[model samples]
Every structure is written in C-alpha cells, then in structure tokens.
Target: MLVAAAVCPCPPLLVPAVAAGAASELADARTACSDALAVLAASRPDRLVVIGPAEEGARGVHPAGAAGSFAGFGVDLTVRLGSGPGGERALPASLAVGAWLLDHTDWADAPIEGLGVGTELQPARCAEAGREIGASAERVALLVMGDGSACRTVKAPGYLDERAEGFDAAVGHALGTADPAALLALDPELAQALQAAGRAPWQVLAGAAEGTGLEGRLLYEDAPYGVGYFVAAWS
Candidate 1:
C-alpha cells in the first residue's frame, strides 16, 4: 500500500544549472516540489520508489545509488538516486530527473529506488508494474515524475494541438483528486497524440493507489516553456 506519493514533472529545466538563464521562471515549481517532498518525509515511509517515463524499450530498475548526470543536456552536474551499492549504471533522463529531485530535497529517511517505464507501454502493464512497486516494501511511498502535454502552445515542442488543453485539464483534475479510475482510464492513444509523457507513469500511480483512498492536493500546474508541468501530493 502507498503511504504517500508525490507527482512531479521530469523536465531537465528543473535543475538551475540545466535551465541556466531560464531558471528563475520555474521558481514556484521548485518550491512546490520541495513542499511535496516534505510531505513525503512527514509520512515516515521506509522506502520510496521513483517512477518516470523513459525511451522505447528502456524499462530499467535503477538502484538507489545509481548515478545521473545532466552532461547530455549541456550541464556537468551529477546526482545519485540514493545510497545503494555504487555502480556505473547511469540513469535514463526521466530517472535522472527523479534522482536529481531526491538529491535536491536531501532525502535521507528511506532508501530510494527508480523505475523507468517506457512511454509507449500499455496501461495494463504500467499498472501492473505499479502494483509490484507498491508491494515491494511495507510502508512504501512513491515519487512519480513525468510531464503532462507538450503541445499546449503554438510554440510547444509538438506544436499547438487544439486537444491539448482539454487533455491536460482532465489530467490535472484526476491527479488533484487522486482519482485512480480516471487515471486508469486515460487513453494511451490520445496521450501519445498530445505528447503527454506522464500517461504511462501516472497509470502506474493509479495502480499503486487503487483502493488506498488517498486524499490529493494539487501543488502546482503550469506550462512553462510550452510544456505542461504539474506537482501534486497524495496522502
């Protein structure tokens, strides 16, 4: 069962070094993420699992001490998932972003693990993975990282799509209310069409929280850089 869960966007821009001049624009997002992590700590969970969308066929389980670096994004900054047995396995971008969040929050109470789910994964499989995660440890907590839609504005990465706004709205509502059914019911086809990276991982969250009755609060929602980023907490 999930004792607590924090949902965050996995943008490289979340890191000040990576964002550079644009860093100030995401100040509120940073604060919201910090507050969400604080909420996770308050739950006193013994373990935390970080889930994020990854490349096609790149389903990897990263250990707590797995390293992550932003050099590929033009930054040399590096972060660790937690304190597992140190290894050379570098985390994928999504898991790297999640690792960066854990490091930034100075998480220490529990060991942290990361799961990278392929973006195109079927909802059923994603949910099953989530169920496994929730059952991995007693008093487990989760940090789900993925972006909403990337086609909100005309300048958006995927270009403006008329359906983007409505899609993001429903996602926002579902996440804010901790509606598992809504999340589970999210259409993968529509999400892919809208370039919503959060679909699969959010389904994983839905699986973990099914029947848990967790109350949710939307911490933040914005479209900085034309991509929908959201932060929420379920407890």
Candidate 2:
C-alpha cells in the first residue's frame, strides 16, 4: 500500500544547470518538491518508486542506481535512481528529472526504483502497473513526475488551447483532494489533445492510492513557460 506520494512536474528546467540563467524561475517549485520529499521521508516507507512519462525507447522498469544523463539536453550532468546495482537501460528524461529531484532532496530513506510509462499507455494498463507497484512492498512511496497542459499560452509548446485552463484546474483539484476517481475519470483523448503529459502517470498514481486513503495537500501549481507544473503531497 502507498504510505506517501509526491506529485511533481518533470521538466528538465527544474535542474539549475539545465535551466542555466533561468533557474530562479522555478525556485518556489523546487522548494515545494523538497518539502514533499520530506513528507515521504517521514512516512518511513520500505520502498520508493518514481513514475514518469517516457518515450517508446525509454518505457519500462529502471532499477535502483540506473544511470541517466542530461547530456541530451546539452548538459553533462548525470544521476542515478538511488544507490544500488546499475542497470543496462538508461533512465528516461522524465525519470531522469525524478532522479535529479531525489538527489536534490538527498533522499536516502528507502530503496529506490523507477518506472517510465509511455505517453500513449492506456488508463487501464497504467492503473495495473501502479497496482503492481503498490503491492511490491509493505509501505510504498511514489515520486510521480509529469507535466500538465502545455497549451496554456499561445507561445506554449502545444500552442494555445481554449480547454487548457479548465483541464489544468480539474487536475489541480483532483491532485489537491487526492481524488482517485477524479483522476481516473480524466478524458485521455482530451488530455492528449491538450498535450497534458501528466495524464497517464497521474492515473497511475490514482490506481496505486485506490484504497490507501491518503490525505492530500497542493504544494504548488503554476504555468511557467506556458507549461502547467504542479506539486502535491499525499500521506
């Protein structure tokens, strides 16, 4: 069962080196992420699983100590999921960002692993994956990483979409309230249309927390660089 969970945005920009001169723009979100990690530490979980959206090549399990680098983003920084045996597969960008967050927070409370869900994965599969993760240990914690709508502004990655605001609002509410049903109810078609990368992973979180009865708090919510970023903690 899930003892605690933290929802965070997966933008590489969250890393100061990746963001370069623009790093300060995400200072508040970074602080909130640190606080959320503290909540996970307090839970004293037996295992920690990081979930994030990934491309086809990066989808699937990434073991603890799996290596990932920001070189693809023009940075030479490298990160590991946690201290453990290394794996052959590299961490996806989303999971890499998750790893970066773990490192930044100095997480050492439990064994760490990662799962990279494909963006096109169906809700049912995502939920099943989550259920498996929740059952993997006695007390499980999750660090979910993904972004909301990228169509908040005309200059956004997906360009302006009239439905973006409403979509993000509902997502914020669901995450803030720990409403699994609400998260599961999100329209995949609509989410894809709005380029909401968080849809699949958030649904996975919903599945994992099905009967955990965790309470939630919204740590932060914002649209920076035309992308919706959110941080929430459940424990």
TM per candidate: 0.96, 0.98
Q: Best candidate, lDDT-wise?
A: 2
lDDT per prediction?
A: 0.88, 0.92
Q: How accurate is candidate 2 locally (lDDT)?
A: 0.92
What value does the lDDT take at residue 219 in candidate 2? Answer: 98
Candidate 1: TM-score? Answer: 0.96
Per-residue accuracy of model 1 over 161-206 as CA lDDT, tens digit each: 9889888999999999999899988899999998999999999999
Residue 115, candidate 1: how far off, in angstroms?
Answer: 0.2
- Report the number of clashing residue pairs per model: 2, 0
The reply for model 2, stretches above 4 Å from the true place, is: none
Error of 2 at 56 (Å): 0.9
